[model samples]
Target: MPSTPDTPSFHALIPCAGTGSRAGTAQAKQYQMLLGQAMVMHTLQALARVPQLSSGWVIVSPGDSFEWPTVNWPDHFRREACGGATRAASVFNGLGVMLQAGVPAHDWVLVHDAARCLITPEAVSQLIEACRDDAVGGLLAVPLPDTLKVQTSTTQSAPSPSGPRVDATVPREDKWLAQTPQMFRLGALHAALAHASATAFAGITDESSAIERLGQSPRLVPGSAHNLKVTYPADLAFAELVLKGRT
Candidate 1:
């Protein structure tokens, strides 16, 4: 079905410019091998199945030479070398490319993390449906199910040999762990990000933060525990186990 002004098309903007220093890999974490293929391949494959995404862009840094495989790559997705130092900048640059490519500013852009290889098609589709007609757009998130804690100021500044100590246990009644496919309109998101870029993108952790600075609250749709971002080295093993179990 073709998109109209009443129903704008959906596009994916994946910021793949991060160095992944936290993942402790020789290469970028997204390019690291997982289940015999690059971790991002799994992420891209999941997005490709959604069917609603009219186009997708993988924003990589200039001079990035990841050697992407040719066979079976999604035709709707393309790689662009306009990534920036931070995730916020990368997405902002990618949005500019989308605009230059003639994509309508009213079209929706689902900005997802490339390291979150465990994201499933159903989850992406769920987010799209939930935010399709939303006034402010939304993101996939899960309610905090465990006890929340705030560490002592001393411990936070300087940890002791005995490990950090919890200062207080906060209520988790309304807390939710934010996750991705943070969906927003192309023009709205671009404007929100442009405002943050003036301050070097401070306090702009995710796409939602940029939107929040504009006094707009994003809706949080239910997400799965399995849709974890592959951050640490140990997480790779855990993600592998989960992926293998699914197979």
Candidate 2:
């Protein structure tokens, strides 16, 4: 895993197939305007700033009707309509497309969320620097500081009409909230995802989880809280504020 002429290069892959239903936007959340540009544009622009990233790819669903913005995209940035029904499926398909396009098996692929528009080039570089030479690659994450609660229904085997009750208080000291630009070897990640798909494991929510299936632990590089995923309507406004402050 040492970097050499024979070692594979790193590339960025953004999964853009999600509909962002929670955001309740008229258009897809990634396509929604944020500070005069598409939300995903901000994400791509940040990745474009990472010099170590040789190229970037966006995975879109087949027959996607959303039009690309007229703004000039970077030469290294490209889009493919090979997205699948689920995020894991989309990443797996994109990995296959990259392989067919001549990317090597050992090449590093940083799978990022398109909705994480607040991610910076520095954060992307941080992940790469930490994981580039490691046996198992890693991802950007933040230590969970909130007091977590395990809620349960008051009634047995059924949810209470009123609401769930706090059944337990979980320790937050050891918890770290996972974030992305989850870097892993293309071959390993593809294989892990393929295995999950074959077994119908719907819990493979992130690249790290997929990698964990192979009994390999990916490193966790500390990332800023600003690198939040835009999942709700209020998140858009928060992202805009963070972007404006950066400018």
Candidate 3:
């Protein structure tokens, strides 16, 4: 968890380099419009608005030459061109730059995704206060309300003329959907990512997974359901509505 001002300082990092293939647009989902501005611009702007944020950096996808003409880019951000095959790689690379640029190991590092355009100042403050203890890192996550299914395959002939009966229904338990703004101690996170990289688990989606590998469970901070990642087509519509309220 990250300590407060009286305890320790912190910095923020946003990984905008991801190519969101699930959104199925020519441009990455982060660059897609939410209202009039780029989706990523909202996410970065929200971070910039947070008074607690000491500094931030963005990692852009290689050769993505498109630049937003109207958005107010943060002065503290530095762009990195090289990103790894996985999300963990991109984060680790950014952390390296931050570490070298005078960010302390004990200072908190908040990692948020670019596609999460719905993130707001209030939500960011929630995450910051929730991460006030350094032993366990924290993230903005919402509890899962729907039942989950685990699939299994069985050998069978071609489908019969009659419809087949449905199998057992899954039960909903204590499942939570993880969101970003995942805050952690700089040294702990760096070590966790390094260990995961050595073990060849490059496909981890978020920072919590890497920390879990080190045997420490991260603390969960409640987040708004409205803070959705702009991935698929429908998300654009929802984001538009959310942004309209802001306008």
- Tell me each candidate's RMSD, in Å, in order: 1.6, 2.1, 3.4
Where model 3 places Cα greater than 4 Å from the true spot, the runs are 1-6, 154-168
Give each model a TM-score.
Answer: 0.96, 0.95, 0.88
What TM-score does structure 1 among the candidates reach?
0.96
Clash pairs detected, candidate 2? none
Best by TM-score: 1
* Cα lDDT tens digits for candidate 2, 1-247: 4444367799999989989999989988999898888999999999999999998999999978987875768789899999998888899999999989988888899999999999999999989989988999999999997999999845555776777778889999979999999999998888898899986658899999999988998998999999999999999999999999988
Once fitted onto the true fold, the runs of candidate 2 whose alpha carbons sit more than 4 angstroms away are: 1-6, 154-158
Ranking by lDDT: 1, 2, 3
lDDT of 3: 0.80
What value of lDDT does candidate 2 attain over all alpha carbons?
0.91
lDDT of 3 by residue, 1-247 (tens): 3454457776777787778899988887888876767888888888888888877888765776767554488776567765666678888888887778767788888999888888988888888888776477889999887777643323444454565544456766767899988999887888889888886656567999989888899998999899887888888888888889888
Reference-based lDDT, each prediction: 0.92, 0.91, 0.80
Report the C-alpha lDDT of model 1 over 100-217, residue by residue, as the tens digit.
Answer: 9998988999999999989998899999999899999999999999999987787347866797788899999999999998999999999999999999999999999999999999
Better of 1 and 2 by lDDT: 1
Which pairs of residues collide in model 1? none
Give the least accurate 10-residue stretch of model 2, judged by summed lDDT: 1-10
